[model samples]
Target: MRTAICSGSFDPITLGHLDVIRRAAACFDKVWVCVSPNAEKKNQLFTPEQKLRLVQAAVADLPNVEAELFPGLLADYAVDHGANVIVRGVRNATDFDVEYQMAIINRGIHPQLETMLLPASAEYQHFSSSMVREMIRYHQPLEKYLPASIIPLVRDMTERKGE
Candidate 1:
């Protein structure tokens, strides 16, 4: 069966992320949403486990999709998971440029794996986890950028932070 891995530091899974996963699921026989742990991002609210759970909750309806946490090189994770494709979501030209370079490097490391970029839906093209968190921090409405279930969690986190 054809398998693909979607890797990101989904500190908080946003609707845009879900849309990308949904699209990837339709293309690959099996899709694994791999949450990468990044110690460099100090403001991250969710741990890798927390992020995995959120992604699992968000994509629960997709039978062919699963969520997990992975560390180290993304290409290494893809190889370990038996995935031949790395699915990425591109929201703008800037993202495309960076992702393109990363894809080239990944290809150089694992020539068998291919990176596929999917454009974000126009409505969510500008939505990002950091943006959503910033809005929630300022008591702004995030009903559009996040799933209903995630709003409460974000609110709770913001409240705890006194933001």
Candidate 2:
């Protein structure tokens, strides 16, 4: 079975992230929506637990996709999940620069693994997790950038954190 891993911090899974995950599902038999472990939880708007739950809830309907936590190198995570491809959603030239370098390093670490840089859909091309976080921070409208289910969860988490 061909499997892919879509790894990200996914502080809060934005619509763009979901778009990539959904697109990845169309190609790979199984897609792992793995959240990379970030030790700087305080800086993050949502805790790891929150992120996991959000990711799980967002992807629950995709029979071939799963949300997981991985703290190690992505290549190792791919190996653990038996994934041959890593799905990356590149929205612009800037994103390409970063993903390109990481793809090279990942290839060096695990020669057999491949990186698939999927372009963002036009509607979500300009949005990102950081942008969404900033919007949430400033109480900006998130109707276009975030999935409907995630908005409430972010609100609840922020309210609980007293933000």
Q: Which candidate should be chosen as best, given lDDT against the real structure?
A: 2
- On residues 1-163, what C-alpha lDDT tens digit does candidate 1 reach at each position? 9999997998788999989999999999999988999877778877677678778878889999998888889999899989999999999999999899999999999999899999999988977888876776678888788777767766776577677
lDDT of 2 at 51: 90
Estimated TM-score for each candidate: 0.92, 0.94
**Clash pairs for candidate 2:** none
State which candidate has the highest TM-score: 2
lDDT of 2 by residue, 23-112 (tens): 999998999988986775446888777899889988878999998887889999998889889999998999999999999999999999
CA lDDT of 94 in candidate 1?
Answer: 97
* Model 2, CA-based lDDT: 0.88
Clash number for model 1?
A: 0
Q: What is the lDDT of candidate 1?
A: 0.87
Error of 2 at 163 (Å): 1.6
